[model samples]
Target: MLTSKQRSILRSMGNELEPILIVGKGGITANTIEQLDQALSARELVKGRVLPHTEWDTRETASELAEATGADVVQVIGRNILFYRPPETGRSPRIDLSGEG
Candidate 1:
């Protein structure tokens, strides 16, 4: 779970990011979940896009992907969605959600 400030910080970081994942006509799949997991692991903050051909809209796609990846949905605007997940126990979190109340 993320506080509003944390989500806000992530959204700002996401503003400069290009969509790393694309949810196309295939919609959400095992492959999509795998890719999202990898992306979230590599980058604490990840942005994805939902194409017009997809059966799900941005919000649904974001919700599904976030649930699948165990990540927080930072924002969903237009066709783009942002996700955030802290690194695992031993690893340092790439994006520091600390220090900000």
Candidate 2:
């Protein structure tokens, strides 16, 4: 779980990242989850979106994806959602959460 400060830092980091994943008309399919898992594993901070055709709204999509991925929902703005997962054990190049209280 992220505190306000941690979430803020991640949000700013997310500002520069492009939406790596897009939940389209298919909604949250297994493929979507798989791609998201891959992206989050490669990059600790990931951004994604739900297209207008999807049945789920912004929060539901974000929350559902976060639950499935075991990643923290940093923020959801408009259609975009930011997710963060600490790198697995022995992994380097993860988000540095140490400095923020």
Candidate 3:
């Protein structure tokens, strides 16, 4: 889990990144979760955007995605969500975890 400060730092680092995936009107489907799981494994940190037509609340969507993917929610700003997971190889990762690391 990331502390508030770590989340803040990650949010700032994530600001320059474009959303790699977009959840459309279909919302968070099983396939989406599966894809997100893979994405988190490969990238560690990722950003996603929610389309305007999505009926789910942004916070709810972010939480659901995080839970489904077993990732931490770094931040949810506007329609965008930032997610993070440490690499599985047990190497020291450069992810700014603030004091939480």
lDDT on C-alpha atoms for all candidate structures? 0.90, 0.89, 0.83
lDDT of 3: 0.83
Report how far off residue 51 is in candidate 1 (Å). 0.6
Segments in model 2 whose C-alpha atoms lie over 4 Å from true places: none
lDDT of 1 by residue, 9-100 (tens): 88888999999999998899999999999999999899999988657889988998999899999999999999999999999877877645
Candidate closest to the true structure, highest lDDT: 1
Candidate 2, residues 1-101, lDDT tens digits: the string is 78887888899899999998998887898999999899999999999988886677989998999999999999999999999988888889568766544
Candidate 3 global TM-score: 0.84
For model 2, state the Cα shift of residue 34 in Å.
Answer: 0.5
* Colliding pairs, model 3: none
Which regions in candidate 1 have their CA more than 4 angstroms from the true location? 99-101
| Ranked by lDDT, top first | 1, 2, 3
Query: 1-101 in candidate 3: lDDT tens per residue?
Result: 77777777788779888888688989888988988888878877899999887687888998999988789988888998899988777667756565545
